[model samples]
Target: MTSTLLSAIPRELDVGTRRSAAIAQFISTARQLIGDPSQASREDLEAVARHLETLGRQATLFPEEDFPVDQEHPAVVYRLSEEADGGFALYLSAALPGKSVLPHDHTTWAIISGVQGVERNVFYRRDKTADPARDALTPERTVDVGLGNSVILGPDDVHTIELQGHQTGLHLHFYGRGLDHMPARVVFESRAGGSYRTFGPPAGIRHARITPQDLKAALADGQEIALLDVRDAGVYARSHLLFAVSAPRWRLPLDIDRLVPRRNTRIVVIDGDESQAHDGAHQLIRLGWTNVSVLAGGTEAWAAAGLEVFSGTNVPSKAFGEVIEHEKQTPWITSEELERLVRQGDNIAVVDSRTPEEFAAFSLPFAHSVPGAELVYRIAEIAPDPETLVVVNCAGRTRSIVGAQTLIDAGIPNRVVSLRNGTMDWLLTGRTLAHGRQTPLPEPSAGHLAGARAQADAVAHRAGVRRIDAATLQRWQESARQQQRTLYLFDIRTRAEYEAGHLEGWRWAPGGQLVQATDEYAATRGARIVLADWDGVRALTTGAWLAQLGWDVSVHAPATHGPGAARVTGPEPVRVLVPDSPAPLIAPAQAAALQQSGAAVLIDIDSRAAYEKRHPAGARFVAPGRLSEFIPTLPAQASVVLISADGILAHSVASGLLRSAKPAQPLLALRGGTRGWIAAELPTDSGGDGVVTGDDDQSYSPYLQKDLALRNAGFVEYLEWELGLVAQLEREGHTGIALID
Candidate 1:
């Protein structure tokens, strides 16, 4: 009866599945034997090693086709299986002949068993007699592991591997914990008092490559995709795909997790060539990003494919504004025409659809600061008489068109028009803009608020935006967590009101900027978005644009005086990931004291322009990316105190510095950064004396450019680019832009 039952089951299980089953059995037996690998004894290690030897003897399970090595990569590592919490991770590695690995210490216990060709493992120990300040290793023993051999290592064990045979080598590697989380793992460059560095997160994945044409097709398709330009901000600002988000390779660790929240979301990294994209793709994979790909030829290929590349940020929003004008045939008044109206003293109200800060910097004549989202809410009050003409303008054209059309869409009883090309056109016509003016929008009357809410709800509903109650929102949040789906909650109110009081976990995103810079706020391409406000008007209006932008957007209005009214105050803090071994933080007073005694040197890693503007009296400016080289040049006994606008960047820079080496000089990060120093009444020097590096770290906006000719030319280029977007969209493909008339 037992033979008949066994014969009934299929005998042709694939080699991969069989190997996985064997690994699971080994892991289960080992867990039963030693529950916590971190505390495993010598006997536990030997027992695991014997189990690995048995796994090694299963020749058919370690199929040659499963692992391949090439010239570009002498060795390739493949993840087999891992615990949900990243414990008991297993991998299969294949290496070609002449491949050698540097001596490294795995931060956790590990075991390796050979399945194919011979591998020479050289063991080493720290030399007790060597100077403690330097790294020194002494040879301990050697082992040649082959088809039936295995090696076991403790947490602190140091070893080097070399493929000695002409044949390709295949082996099984089991670790106490996954390599992804081992930020503290270290590797030595040489055996005798050489420098050492921590092993950074793995950055190699055999990712699929997509051409520029493939990217175009993907964008045209309805599915969400994040096209990330992995170049530096300054370089990316020069030229990039219109829909591409700037996510520099250096900042991926700090930004990617937040930007692309869904692990399975499709993402394509773009660079000048494919080099940075390849590296960025691997890093994304290491961070558990599964559906990542590299643009085969990057941005250069896009340009080569006869596709137009855009300069400046928020290209998608800017382009969409042009489309709105073309499709809606929205009324427009040129700078010349508007000037004539002002001269004639017509009953007109010019409202700037830009932030109050922007209005304060420069604006047209007789314009009031009524930012985009506020346009609908405050328009009735701004133009009391039904016959009054309302004109909206922005720094460029997007906000102008979007703002004016918003009122038009809401059925406001007034002649609505956008200032053609906005303030850039005004400037190009050689007109001086009003500066140092602060015009805030007044609160609308209660009657006007009710009307505004009704209009906004109508517009949002027309745009296909869904509405949800607070209870529904809570349920959706829970469902997102359970499904590992990406969800973003934004308070689409003015920055000041948002900071004064907002939903506890919701992030503050000014309504207009949210539409203009969607990529900046939520990095995930296809995440669910929920916008909230005190009244439903602003959130609904913003939701309209987002829905048209292909977002699964919903609007929520919290009760003003009820159980749902609880809110948190203060700005949200920026989140960053620092290196494993962070530098010690020094308080402002302590740092000042050290500086006063000439025992410490301050390094400001802020932008060169900012460093030149204001910095500690003796602080020297250095880019964070160049800190490693700059550290070795400092005085041997001097404590290096790093500072930024706030202490966050200083801590980040310090962490990176510590990760690479044990500096002879004492390394420190300012506890409160430069802000703390100033609050403590410390002396500061202004101007370029302290700027030791080039001004390349931060990109400059056209408004901030010092060269008038260049600035004016950039404005023209930008306006022209916006005007040409509709034609390009028609020629190339759609970006899920469908306007609701």
Candidate 2:
């Protein structure tokens, strides 16, 4: 019976299934041997290691073909399980040849069992007489770990492994606590009689893995789980798991707060590649996520397991909008009907509820840009007459729904409706869009202000939004600092309003955009957020949505006098203190002369895209991150002049180069940088030469690409992506978004 169970499965069955089954057995056995890693005895850990070695020896358990070593990312980690409190983690690691790991302590009990090839493990012992502040590691012994060979390390064990042989190697590692969770680990170097340094572990952890079936079961059981797809927008628009929110891998750390909000929420991340999913899960864990996991095989495994996948960005939010529209039978007007109404001189006001840039690019005739969150604030100004009809629109349906509903919820007396499907639908119906029309909302009258204030106050009360005076807000700010919590003061009004006059110390974040992309503005989950506006309407409306989103939000009304009084002027001048360096500063003309004379090589330290746009003639682009590697590539005798968009980056780069051993040449920073050169009317060029040191930091949108076919395809895919979001939301279960009647 055991032989039958261990027999090789058919080739048709995915390798993920077999690997998952083996990992499940290992998890079960480990749990039985050591119920809780933190409380487990040394003997218990050793017994668990022995069982793992037996499993490793079974060819059926860990087929070599299933665990291929990647050459690019040599260490591929497959997490099997982790204790709830992060006390322990089990994983399968594949290491390719030419890998050499420096000597380091795990800081916790760890076990390793080899399944393929060979690895040389060197053990190290700390010197008793060494200073406590520094690390002094002495080599003790070596062990050859081949197939079925196992090594068990106590909490204080230190070792290093090198895969010097010609073949790739695979091993299973179990840690008392995941490496990422370990606050500090010591690394040793044998340079100049050896020195040691303490550094944080790698960014990610070997987070728990879940099978598609398990995820499906969890959803069926109504578990509150956040399924995130960590892929680029283009890929996410192509296909993703149902109800999965699009939080690209690169933006996960920045955007996680808005998507999940609560660190304790159960999260399952998926990507096209297992490595990316694992890395993303680790990043989340590193950011204080307590319950995070990765899908074993990503979307492929989920599909293979007969689960549905979806497509698009903001799938849940878009879908929720659709549900609200359908259930409430939200009022909407077709493009043709709206055009007819305009032609007939109907008493209607059209408002574009998108970004100002988007509205400026193209908009409907007679439309003014009043973004979603500002709709309630500026509606009275746009349509003072209670009988006037109001129409809201965006590039698509979501913002339109939100904008129209916001006004409706605020008890605005004007008849309101969303432009069905927004601009895309208008274009499909052969309506020509007007470009560069800057129609501004009229100044509010006394009646308009009074009505808007009353409506906004009502909505805020309904959303349970608290309104604090300046004194109370200051108290909260001071309390937050004392408690080690974050407090964000955002001026939620139009950019024009913010720039013309605003309160000191309040950073400008427009109300509509803030609600749309809360993650971009506030990173700290559960942080206190205070919204401020000249008029009470904008702040209250924006505060309502933030409060609903689970933020500890409040609206602050500026005082008539004192520190909270609004400032009526442009932004305060910023004073930056640059570090004094011995390196010389060259003027634009002097640098130009040096370049022409071939005495100095210009290296731009700004973003690759910015550098490519415009830079001093003969300038080579080098990203700041690749400065060390790029310095060695430069001619040792050539005087290097570093410049950035501004002088800040230039000064910083020059300072670092002066300290480095390489570049054996005189390094200088341009006095003002590329902006100064441009201001001085110096010769500039736009294009990259043969020199490139690192990856470009900016990613261009597929829809914005020059290729007509690609752009058109992206648009088509985007529309389909948006269309499917409503269905996906219904499948996932209703998200707790309130649509006011």
Candidate 3:
């Protein structure tokens, strides 16, 4: 059977194709050993496990890009091979830090072996004193499984898996049968005092198939659906359903949780064909996402149905911006006109309607960073004279037009117009941009605050944005916690203001960036969005736009004196699971001493840019995620010390290193990282020569490309795409977006 399968495959093929061929051979051998997986003996299972581990050691066949770790779900499982009868199933599991699975029984024999990083496996034993029905279990033993390690389990063996710290883990698992066929698997919810609750028989996974026409109908009826294109980001950006979000299959585990927080939200995945979509749907189900479906024929079917597919990121928001421009005839001036006005010394206040960072990077001369929602709230302060001409600009069309119209709609007395095509056009027309300008719009004066508030309130109400009190917000938060629905709470203020003071539980999403990248802020299509701000104008204005974008949005302002009214200070905290035992920390002086005396090998795990800026002399640079690869290269007795920009990353790296295959030795993280060393006035080297590992950790957007011509072309292509969105949307028969009367 293996020979026959191999003969069907082409002799010359890609690594993935070759890997598939090898998988077929491995499965054939496994079948010969196990005979019938359900009746396989202990020796048979052990033999099969050994073969699987040997196959797993061929890490070159499994690229890390095929398994991305994002902010969504911490782990993803890729099906490597499975028998026709669903026996002898094999999977590649890639897990990022902070992943924890409850004690669970596979109901079949299984073997797990590591290819990279560390995975802690804790075996559990059912308590003899407890009733079988109680499902009570206690930890029996724990093992740190990494490279050159494997754990085998019987059909009824129960175990929990955890990945701690910052590194990602790549492991191979061989199971008696595929997960889709395992309807009787048991998950033990262990509690205090050895008590446990059984999740009972697994809910049978199902992926509903929806045709392109039906999906269009659902959207036309304004049904809440997250149409996700599960293709690669680059591919998805080229062409995708207008409303579909780019939730790549590889990134689904890392991004799906945040992109579509509600597991039960209607999620439809699409790829080139139904193959990837079906796989993505199954993975989503395994990750506890209840409502998932596959597009019947994926993007090809949609295009075949005569529905126009869009080319760009944030299609919905960008299209809506175009639609608004078309409907409202938002006034605009070309780059030439703006330059002429500037040269004539006209009474104009150029407001960059983008984030402060973007405005500071490259903005028109004399332009102040007023940002998106702030255009309405602070226009009164920016262009105090009603006769002043206010020109709004963003990187390109969307925010420029939207921000300009926002001011006009808010009844600002000034004459407002957008800089056509924004900075992109300004550059294209041979005009220069000013860099590092720090003029941000200030708060509205006491005299104009009331008027701005009233205008914003009227606009929000007109757009059907609801105003919720603190009590209602609390109820919604509780309901969201209970998983009854998905709710997103955003403080629509500038980061500076948000960090200075914000509601404790709310996340800081600056109003402009939130609008610019709505998918990033909220992935659940039907999820409720609640905006917070000290004053009502910013939240209301932001909510008004959100409502226009077909979101169920509400604005809230907590009472001045109340239990939940106190504002917290500092940046929002990130949540990640730390190791059971803390990473050992050595103070900067001690670490320096150790390094100077050749007792410790100092490794800098900060970003390439940070490492090149100023790292401790003689320190070696390696990307944190690739630390495991570097660990084995050192001498067996080499004392390792990790350093990052801050001590936090060093601690995480150190914790993950302890679980690697390195020999037992004292491994310590530099306390306070490089910051502490620099603060202590330690000697430092400033160059990239110490970097042993190349920089490829981050993906750059088209606009951020280093190639000058490519960047310019990207800007042009992007602007053109945005301009064409409204036309495409018009051509489509069904759309959820609707402008308010």
Best by TM-score: 1
User: What would you estimate as the lDDT of candidate 1?
Assistant: 0.78
Which portions of model 3 miss their true places by more than 4 Å?
A: 1-209, 220-223, 230-232, 248-254, 274-279, 576-710
Better of 2 and 3 by TM-score: 3
Query: For model 3, how does the per-residue alpha-carbon lDDT over 1-741 read when each residue is reduced to its tens digit?
Result: 233554554554434434555665677788888788899998887777666666666666566654554576456676655543456767778777878888887888998888787888999776655455565667889888777678888888889889855778888888888775576776765521143444542222224456778677666543346778776565667678877887755345456666777655667788766656865675565455544556777888889988787776777787888998999999999999998988999999999988888777778887888889787788888788999999999888999988988988888888999999998898878778888888846878887898999999999989999989888998998988875668988998888888988888788888877887897668767679999857879999999889888889998887788677798999976543342245789988888888788788998875666787789888988755456667777876668998888777677657645633333667888999999999999989988788876543322344455577887887888888788877887797556576776
**What are the models' TM-scores?**
0.76, 0.58, 0.61
Candidate 1 lDDT over 640-692, as tens digits, reads 99998888767765765564456789888998888898998888987777666
For candidate 2, write residues 229-251 as lDDT tens digits.
67555555556775566665544
Per-model CA lDDT versus the true structure = 0.78, 0.69, 0.75
Select the stronger candidate by TM-score from 1 and 3: 1
* Runs in model 2 lying further than 4 Å from the true structure: 1-320, 469-479, 482-487, 500-505, 523-528, 547-552, 563-677, 680-714
TM-score for predicted model 2 compared with the true structure: 0.58
